[model samples]
Target: MAKRKGKGPTPKAEDRHWHGKRQKARAAKNAKRTGTPTMGPSGRPTATDSPRPSGRPAGARRAAGDSPELVTGRNPVVEALRAGVPGTALYVMSGTDERIRESIQMAADRRIPLLETGKNELDRLTDGAVHQGIALQVRPYRYAHPDDLLKGTAPLIVALDGITDPRNLGAIVRSAAAFGATGVVVPERRAAGVTAGAWKTSAGTLASVPVAQATNLTRQLKAYQQAGCFVAGLDARGSTPVADLEVASGPFVLVVGSEGKGLGRLVADTCDMLVTIPMPGKAESLNAGVAAGIALYEISRLRS
Candidate 1:
């Protein structure tokens, strides 16, 4: 050899194997700390990247035991499940009730978590309401914008001016779904949003009906008017009768007022026509839901 001795001793096989193991351990630790997959040699996700099927995603599993809506009663829970409500879990009291069994089966069918708890816990979850030994934890409802209602195929829509009753809102939603109304619009403030009660009252029809919230109902009515929809306000002393209204066959927005007050002056004035459902008896008026249902029925009939 010509004195060319610059190379050091080659590493042993054991050393090389230990170094490879150390690198893999470090990579796995880093992956665990960052909650990401261990990158492969090509910097791509591998089979190890698959998350363990332990619990729900982060922030989805509520530890505080508070849910957005706790749907109580067997019928309500069953209907909610049938309506495809986004349920987190189903809580059934420790019993052998057939309804609870049905609920459990339904939840299992939908992959919804099922928990067996004491009746007292169910009562606590429902705030002492009549839970009927069952409760469903559902996600909050997401309301659409006023314009979304107008984009549907059906031009018939219902606008609630000041209806604050959640049941009425739910009934209106149910009626809207039944009568082929495209959607329902309510004011964003001073009115009822879709709540658990509304969902229950709607008999699961809330899933199909799109409810929109408007910043300014009068402005929304004006916008509907500009869009070639006849804005009609339901009132006692309206100019047009629900039965004889010619615009029912066309694109129309039926505006129902609050239970106590008929309609606001601005909203009533903004209407292209005022409609009254004829009552043969001396009853002054009807509830918001009944009135809306009647109007929807007449419109549906006219369209058919």
Candidate 2:
């Protein structure tokens, strides 16, 4: 077979400029002191001082959109391993903490290959993230289509609106799993995608729970309503208590949004009903994750 060609998309100029500015300044200063021109041997300006690629690995920040994502930092890596996020390889160095060794052992047990990389190379690979001498490369997540999650008898779906945090997405997925929901749906744009942080937060529940993306959240919720599912939007000002939402016994979809701003106006209008979680204490609002969890639990309880 002929050798492969084409390196891929051209990196931005900033990413290409890995050379230290101090070195270039020093070179210019020397040239000025000697009364000589500062140029490469070939007489081209900036030719001798050309920026070199970091040679960052595939999962690095430089290639984020590319398949696979690198889980950097020691605690995150260990959590990923413990959560059983499917990994392709473990890039690590020596003299790390006990957590690193534990992660290595986990990788070995799972038959995931360990490639010993140096500090500089690992830094380049992670795009300057604190890797703590260890990182795990996980396969790209395959998202389910919004309609694909509509299957199953009396399917229950959870739709998220403007929830940008991956950890919140993971928590919602976990609750969806616990409450026997069909799947979780998130807006395709301006929403969090499955990442290392989500994997760690889900504690591996994400492996079984599928997350679907919707191009338009309100439209998708309308579709769900047309399909005969009762759509409920969780908001602080809602008049209906989540516990009394007897609609959970049948086809249902619960929409959640950010805590600060609550649900978007369009999404709120799309829902068939609006439900609120009652809190008698001094607390004001719940986090997206916690709110989703409480709502899902109540819905589950009502269904049971």
Candidate 3:
């Protein structure tokens, strides 16, 4: 048999989400008018439902670092520090590098513990990633409950479904903060958690915009609907454009999904409305971050 050929270098995390595909919009052969997922006879998930790397199963992408909580590298560490990512300690090795000294100074200023160790230990700490003799251990993120986001008379909340990328979560939080969203809700499992990458990309907005974790996203969405909140999920198959949402001025929850998979089956069904962002551009769809930003902007405009 012929040997398996290589797939070439992997794409970056930011570029992998719905970026490579450029085909024209095709009708969802099995999709219903409601845009719900069609299951196989055995009730197993379809090809789109199967867990694969990024949106396209053919191409793969690697994350920027070994771990989200342990931010490593000279530039990343400094940027995380500048972005005010909450940290417990700053690990470093003795070196004349100016960035290392600068990291030490910042850690000292922020009262983060400084743990000097050998290069070997640094590599081990970073899981053999390129550390450049520095790493920062981010404090474990504190997640909120779904109900805690219900604040004020008409609160807006953003819930993420199938969005495992922390950067996308950060971008959504930033949008949420701008549009007066109460907080963000994410599934406790199979979803992105607040991490150093999230903090950096959020530009510290995560601090103000608390992210709540839900054990069952579908249940939480139902609960929101029961509590008199309009639930909307962003999807390419949505009939109603986001700008025309009828319940914008009321208590609302906007759900965003991953780039490739869009909204999961049950989560999409849970939404009161599946809202689409009408993109007249040649592109077929937008990533979660961009989609959330546009949807939130439209919702805010409607509320205003």
Best by lDDT: 2
Best by TM-score: 2
Judged by whole-model lDDT over C-alpha atoms, candidate 2 comes out at 0.81
The C-alpha lDDT values of all candidates are: 0.78, 0.81, 0.79
Question: Which of candidates 1 and 2 reaches a greater lDDT?
Answer: 2
Ten contiguous residues minimizing lDDT sum, candidate 1: 57-66
lDDT string for model 2 (1-304, tens) is 8998999998875567654676678887776455344565666433222221132432222123434578777787887889988887888887458999999999999998787778887776676777788878787788899888888778889999989888898889988888898899998778888876787778888988899989899999999989888999999979999999997889999999898999999999989889999999999999999999999999988888
Pick by lDDT: 2 or 3, better one: 2
* Clash number for each model: 0, 0, 0
Off by over 4 Å in 3: 1-68
Residue 6 error, candidate 1, Å: 54
RMSD of each: 10.5, 13.8, 19.2
